[model samples]
Target: METLGEGDGPIDIHDYRHGLKLLKETRETSLWTNKKGYACPACGKPFEQLFTSEKQHNTFSPSSVTPFCIRREADRVLMFRH
Candidate 1:
């Protein structure tokens, strides 16, 4: 199966978190160290931290939601919602 951030497909939460862990291991912060107008999918509240959730939410109701973090430093993109 194609892994998250590998193929031209959407990302999974578990895979997203795992990627974060790997990034953390190499550095103290993320490579996409900037926000590119990221916001909440449900409420539209702007935020920076692209986090994962295992609880009830609007975007992925029920449970187990794997969101993305699309940010922009100068001219890039990141992701997240919660």
Candidate 2:
């Protein structure tokens, strides 16, 4: 994935969005994560969506919950990274 930071170059919000779009497109069908509607090849099970918050606290803004998906198995809860 393209790292957006000062060392590489000036990163714009549009650039970030474009990168995300590309990533999503490239791995839309691949079973990279266990999201809802995603069939896991390792284990035959479906996933349930979940939400967690990322710390983005600033002087003018607060953090918000980011929706994600996970599959709870007997041994672990497979968290989706997409």
Candidate 3:
């Protein structure tokens, strides 16, 4: 994964937010952020965030869910949904 602002070409904030929204909406559980830029606990790779879906394969029923932010662990992404 590449940083949103550091790439060959510039990307619009809309696109970035759109991707995040898609991940959040499609994801089964929730999205996780590896802000610390450390290896994932499960995969062991440097990531800014991780998406954990409660449903397998990021499948979900209704697609109206919204994403929320996690506190204290700004470096890591946490499950915002139940």
Best model number under TM-score: 3
Cα RMSD, each candidate? 12.8, 14.5, 12.1
TM-score of each: 0.25, 0.22, 0.30
Score residue 77 of candidate 1 by CA lDDT. Answer: 32
For candidate 1, write residues 1-82 as lDDT tens digits: 2223443444343444432332222222232211344334433554434533222322434442445444333322334533
Prediction 3 TM-score vs. true: 0.30
Q: Which model scores highest in lDDT?
A: 3
Q: Tens digit of lDDT per residue, candidate 3, span 1-82?
A: 4334343343233444533443343423455344434333333334454454333233334652543222222232333331
Evaluate model 3: give its lDDT.
Answer: 0.37
**Candidate 3: minimum summed lDDT over ten consecutive residues — where?**
68-77
Clash statistics: count for each candidate: 13, 0, 9
Candidate 1 is scored at a TM of: 0.25
Worst 10 residues of 1 by lDDT: 25-34
- Candidate 2: segments with Cα more than 4 A from true spot: 1-64
Error of 3 at 3 (Å): 20
